[model samples]
Target: MAFTQIEDYGVIGNLETCPLIGNDGSIDWCCFPHIESSSVFAGILDDDGGGHFAIQPSGEFESAQEYVTRTNVLRTTFETDSGTMTLTDFMPVVDGVELGHTTSAIYRKVTCTEGTIELDATFEPRFDYDRVGTTVEQTSEGVIARGNGEQLYLWSPADFESSEGEEEHAEATETLRADETMWFVLQYNDREPIDAADCAALLRETIDYWQDWTHQCLDASGCPFEGPYHDDVIRSGLVLRLLMNPQTHAIAAAPTTSLPEEVGGVRNWDYRYAWIRDVSYTIQALNELGHEREARNGFDWCLTMCHKDDPGEIGHPLYGLHYPPEMVEEELDHFSGYRHSKPVRIGNAAGDQQQLDTYGELITAIYTATDYGEEIFAGEWEVIEEVIDHVSGVWTNKDKGIWEVRSEPKHVVHSKALCWAALDRGIKIAEDNDFDAPIDRWKGERDTIRETVLEEGFDEELGCFTQTFEGETVDAAALRLGSVGLLPFDDDRMQSTIDAVMDHLMTDEGLVMRYEGDDGLPGEEGAFVLCSYWLVECLALSGRVEEAHDVFESATEHLSPIGLFAEEIDPETGEHRGNFPQAFSHIGLINAVLYLNQAEPGETLDPIGRGATEITTDSKS
Candidate 1:
């Protein structure tokens, strides 16, 4: 059997957890309660050995799929030799609505739309990645999946005959004629697992809950981003939220990591971790679209998980979903990574690195808390001040830049600019709210960073700032100079830097490479999607609307058939690569949309790159 590509999986989830459903109606990956939880279907990891939950026609079939309008509900229809059938997948809301902290459940309804079709319904609920034996029984509660570490009730009204099966595979069959239907519900609860017979009403209620939640998203134009593509964003945002840990503020970079960008590349690693750089852009995009809660939660989660040694000791640039900075990266002993990209890791090693921008991003998020008219919790603000104080002490000494390059560290311009923003916002807080901060020290450091960039980082011959003080080559991340308000969009230096990056690092297709130097890797990879979006922002900021549109249109062409983008795009083949449905890529799409929409003169738009501090928790609203 051929395995589906990573891009082929459709996602559904509540804010707390998600499941990946292949077009063939097989759920290959799902973690209850949170993305980092033990998988119910780790088949995406082991392919043959991993367990799965599948409901598809037994015979050959034609399949077509789409998400429910403006909601994360996914519908896939299969036209089999016998008949046509449809399956709609969604999560049941706790109280028939989503507000504050909420729980989630995956509910799937299968129905026949044509002549009699013999279909199959099979669920092999594997706990802790199929590492334990499980017992099943058709209780009054539904299909109970019990294992050593966990217990869950799988509720179904489908015509299913319960039987014990092997850990790796399970099966059930149903012959349905036209207009026939079945409903399957999988409810996960620790204290009160769902115990019931028929959940048709609950299924309808869940569907209504999702539809109602979609209504809350009012785009800037007073309508949620609509059309075929709008559904994609809504679905993506919905799925990404599942990566959030509801009790905590943590949101994973991806639900699973070490799914290689290129098949057979050992670069595959776990993504169920948080990165400061990734969420910085995520906050802005989610905020612009009116998802304020998600934005605030992302920032709060980051602050709670991060810890520092002494003030001078670098705080981690990233963290695990569940633990603090010291969490050891766990490598699976049994299963190979997706497509046999071996050494599948569980925790993030990036946690211990000294990416200088994390403090800036955290501070910006704090600043955003005030800007959006939300409050950073009292305890969290104290931590924010601690981090800002640490930034104040180390603003000038460069460790790692925002890209987290493995190469030797240098005084990267973007990282330096971020430090300036940290100090700038820190001073802003001190003035606005009468918080006692080392305002003089912060201002001194901020100005020092600016003067250092102007004097040392600028390359006179190239007419732009270099990536790092000692580096001669231009980098694409320098394009953010305009966007970050380190300098104005129309400033000659900003224009030169954009042109320099475009001239040196841009591919023939206009995609941007992250840098010119070796990033501790042996060879080059695909152009980063975020960098390309930054190009569009820089283009728009400089009054190059036509050029910006050309760039934006070209980037959208890279989305997978399901209208999702990975982290990068291959330059030669134009194939999508890196993590599928990457947060950074979707965030890039939203940023580009905003920039493109603002190109018209009478829109009364604010300057996109004008004095625009890094979009943080404070900025989203």
Candidate 2:
């Protein structure tokens, strides 16, 4: 029903790439070799048509799944009328011989849990989403599925059937009479085969690998928690770190493909790309947990994507796997979208938009990186100087806001405040780094932005900062005005702004939306998960720790039973929407928990949480 809602899926990846595993035990969406490839198994889009790779008990089975401790090793167990079986999914993490953090490969294994149970495994490989077709060969080891230009080999147990174009009957039959075991191996052509006997041994190796790396945050996890939802906040941070591109150092939105924003709503766009606006919360989350690698990757992407060299040059509102300026947007007209949300696009059209707040986010990233003991890029600093100079010149002009609504542009308050913050942080950077910038010019522009916002951005009658200048509509984004420090939380404007957003933007579920009136689309969407966390953060910053914890706990109620968060949640049915296991949602949770902890010290927070906040705040002082 409703295409199972986007957020119902759990993510498994080898840093080089990721594949989403839905609750149904199917590999619903998977891109080979990288996060941005044609789907090999995409049951997430069409349960019947879209191909899938799954292994569970054939008969009726009650299911439970969890990641094994610190590693990405996933253990999903199914209890049926016959017996119980567990599927261990993971990406292989190899350390360089010299030591430190470096990944090599990933491996997924399936095993027998407590009771030996027969399993039904199915391998339906649909190359290129719709099916350009793969050359399937019955290898001595298993079925080697090969697609044109895609060398990913899918090896399953022998006896798997096939078809000419769309392979459907490729099933792994298990009779419950004895213990049955099966493994699916998807590997690039250039590597040697991994020696994995059963899924449990591989699961053990993967767990050790992740524990070794995540052990670095063992202390950070012990921080006092703010609410009942502490574990969720921490793991979200870990997910963000893993999603970042190690090569380009950019963080993609979700390591997924074609998981539509609206089910059958024709609003499906590829979220496997990065946006600085999204990374603002991401940076804060990583820094709080002391996760340096992901924090630095976020900063790297922000610097490259910010158009800091020419901030006024129609800044790229978003980016794909890399930060190339000319990366064009195109729609995949062939494949039907997840839940039939058509116009499945790979690149982002928001790249050329003028979201004024993005530069401010860039500033926040750099400043936070600096504060977290990270090295600032020499080239990026030069570009940032120019970008800050540009913001100083045109802080009042507005083209598009953060939501990137397709409608006409307006003077959005969030955009203006970020502009002010960009200049303010730039001034701080220039002073700290002893760089010669147009200081006098920047200060004047910053002053103007502050005054203009106080006068025009505030609604006197509503006693709060409106979404747009003097607009009555309160926005969930307004919660960031204080979070970004354009105004202090004690200010009446900031407090009222939070109140107005909560009063207007919130639904009965306690989640929020971007705005009330319009978002340029026709159908109603789910509650914005990030916006709700912003409310939690706002509550904490406003010295309402208990309230913030309460809100945070309420938000966690929407998580799928397996501890995964999505982009949005249904207002009525409480189902999740947008992409599954979205890093933005998790990062928001991490940052909010940090604010709650700062507000009050009560629950002992595990410093080694997956979503470590100290890492996001690391910078080069």
TM-score, predicted candidate 2 vs. hidden true structure: 0.89
Q: lDDT tens digits, residues 1-621, model 2?
A: 135555556677766678777666777777766676667777776666677777777777888778777666677777877677767777665454113243333355566645657666676677777557666655555566666666555555546655454453356575443355556666654334544464446566666756666524356447544356566755675577567776777677887655656666765656777777677667656766656666777777666655434567534566666445334567767656776777767666777788888788878777877777766656667877888877776766766788888888889998998888888888888877888788888888887887888778888787788889846777888877777776666676777788888788888768888788866777777788888888887787677777777778778788877677778887888877777678778877777767676664333222221211121111111
Could you say which candidate leads in TM-score?
Answer: 2
Model 1 regions lying over 4 Å from their true place: 96-104, 132-148, 152-168, 187-198, 215-236, 298-314, 323-326, 375-383, 460-464, 522-524, 572-574, 600-621
Question: What TM-scores do the predictions have?
Answer: 0.86, 0.89
For model 1, how big is the CA root-mean-square deviation? Answer: 4.8
Worst-scoring 10-residue span by lDDT in model 1: 612-621
RMSD of each: 4.8, 5.4
Report the C-alpha lDDT of model 1 over 1-621, residue by residue, as the tens digit: 346676677877776666888889988888876776777777777787666788999989888778766666788999877779999987755452334345456777888888888888887777777678877667654577777657766766554556766743335687778887777777665424443333566566656766655425444556435443455466556655555565556666777656665665655656676676666666666676667777777666556543444544334566656654434677776876677766666666666667777666666665665666666555655666777777777866767687766777788888887777777777777667767777887777777777777778788898878888987878887776556566666566777888888888788987877778766754457788888888887787677778777777777777766676677887898876666667777777777776766675322133431224343221111
lDDT of 2 at 492: 69
